[model samples]
Target: MLSAVPRFAKIAAVVVLAAAASLATFDIADARRAGSSGFGSRGMRTFDTPAITRTAPTQAAPIDRTMTPRPQQQPAAQPPLGAQQRPGFFGGFGGSMIGGLIAGGLLGMMLGHGFGGGFGFLGLLLQIGLIMLAISFAMRFFANRQRTQYAGPGASYNNSAMNNANASPRPSFSIPSIGGGTAASQKARQANDEIGLQQADLDRFEHLLTEIQSAYGAEDYATLRRLTTPEAMSYLAEEFGENATHGVRNSVSDVRLLQGDIAEAWREGDSEYATLAMRYSSIDAVVDRATGKLVDGDDRNPSETTELWTFVRKPGSDWVLSAIQGTGTH
Candidate 1:
């Protein structure tokens, strides 16, 4: 045992060191794009899930940080006024008998009766069987009582009426199929129609994607503030601050949109929101701040990334970045 102590201590130290290294690696990877998960607000739909699109078929990560308040849930329905509340299982005579049996068994054990009134293990088993039987009988009795209560004169009439309503054939209308477009395009068109997104709006979205990447890479706080909401700017600024503290800087450039479509668009009061799924290619890399030497990522080859970016605008204002959600590596 004395010799084994050193071996155990060595093993524990190795495990701890391994865990710490893994965490450090994860932290570096997370800082690559918008700090891993989603952040910023989407107005009233901040917590709501966005629709899946061609660019982002998988579910987008939920926004973990937002200034928007969560919608309140409706209260549960209450029982009808003056209606008698149903008694719980333990409120009846059957429950009293079971309770007494359990108490008696506990008392028997305390008095050295082996939970069977001094009759030993076989008696204990017999008592358990009897208790199970009592429980079965109680359940059946309660079930029958509930059934009888609802089996009134009006019950048959109500059931018949429901059957008749369901049996009747309902008239159907045929919707003309949209001709010659992929399912993704159809879905995108439908989403765009919801908020009246024009071609100009889409062109602006592509432009902003490139502009934001360029601004972020350059650490141009002014341009970032102009292009994004205050809430979004805060998160981006926080990521930048973290990179500076770690003695590194993120370099992103040559951003080009490969594929993109509107995931969802809606209007809440005066503010119009559009969540777009975009697959874009950019030269993203991290470099040592002091020497400007490459620390991580390929600076030469532009890497592709799929993300859901939500933009918000008022009546006559240009759309601004409101949220950024990663759809994993793909």
Candidate 2:
């Protein structure tokens, strides 16, 4: 009876060891990174919070320049006219006037020499009269054109002096100054308002850091899209797709913020952006999507990491994640 009892005990021990090994194997298989770093593709901006940073990782192109202001284009200059159109008896008269004056002078000289020894001959007198008439007509045409341009259409020379007297005054504007005593006081008040806004930004940054990780763990891509910029969302979607292809999933939980500090904040056009360096601890694990078995990262161990995140918001708008940068795990 004692020998039989010992054999049974040995069989039971072997069964117990086999069961433990099976459980260990179950815990070892897990999905790959489901979407770490919020899947943001914004390049290694690190401390770069500028709006001009690349929208995706490894991209070497310029950023969208829509936020920058540009000068308005001025109208093109009109080409000068080489010739003028003439109308009625005086049409194209500038050349005619010059020609007539020369012809009349020659006729007058010839007539004067033959009829009155170049003194007071009737023919010469007639030619001199014609020349004077042509000169007066040319002067009249020039004076009329000048009046038409300045005084506008349908204006009459009879009231030319009256129109000049009634011209409207030049425009005047009063500009507000920012250097005087009262202006300086206003500027100081504005600075105080900016301080309050920055505090709100800090609060938002902390909230997003936790919320974004939770969404990544859950593989809630829709939530990520709403919280992050289009570029960041696309990058995250790609990570999710890669995980799906490999039949793996990442799990993150117990996200606790350890420390955070603002690197910089500035307004561009109607939007404001902030860069933050944050240290945090979280339980991050990869598992098999189909079996929910842990693949990597100790489920019992929480990790500490440092990262830089940038958020942007417009007036009366909610903050959205624009970028993420990672530092090595601690």
Per-residue alpha-carbon lDDT of model 1 for 1-330, expressed as tens digits? Answer: 334333433443344345446645764676665434799998888897776655565667888888888888889779899998877565876678777766665444544453455555556556655665666567668867877786775689557545644553221111111212244334445553477666567767878999999999999999999999999999999999999999999999999888776777889999999988888899999999899899999889999998889999998899999999877764
- At residue 318, give the lDDT of candidate 1: 96
Judging by lDDT against the true structure, name the best candidate.
1
TM-score, structure 2 vs. true: 0.44
Among these predicted structures, which one has the highest TM-score?
A: 1
Q: What is the C-alpha lDDT of each candidate?
A: 0.74, 0.55
- Runs in model 2 deviating more than 4 A are 1-197
- How do all models score by TM-score? 0.58, 0.44
Flag clash pairs in model 1. Answer: none
Worst 10 residues of 1 by lDDT: 171-180
- Please state the error at residue 303 of candidate 2 in Å: 0.6
Q: In candidate 1, how many Å is residue 305 off?
A: 0.5
Task: Name the regions of candidate 1 deviating beyond 4 angstroms.
Answer: 1-35, 73-188
Task: Give the per-residue lDDT digits (tens) of candidate 2, residues 1-330.
Answer: 334333323443344345435545543453223223333422333323222111111112222222223345588655568654344334456657655655544443333332123444444445445544655566567767766665743466435534433543111111122112343333323331232333344456667988999999999988998898887777777778998899998899888777554444566678776655567789998899999899888677899876667677778989898876654345
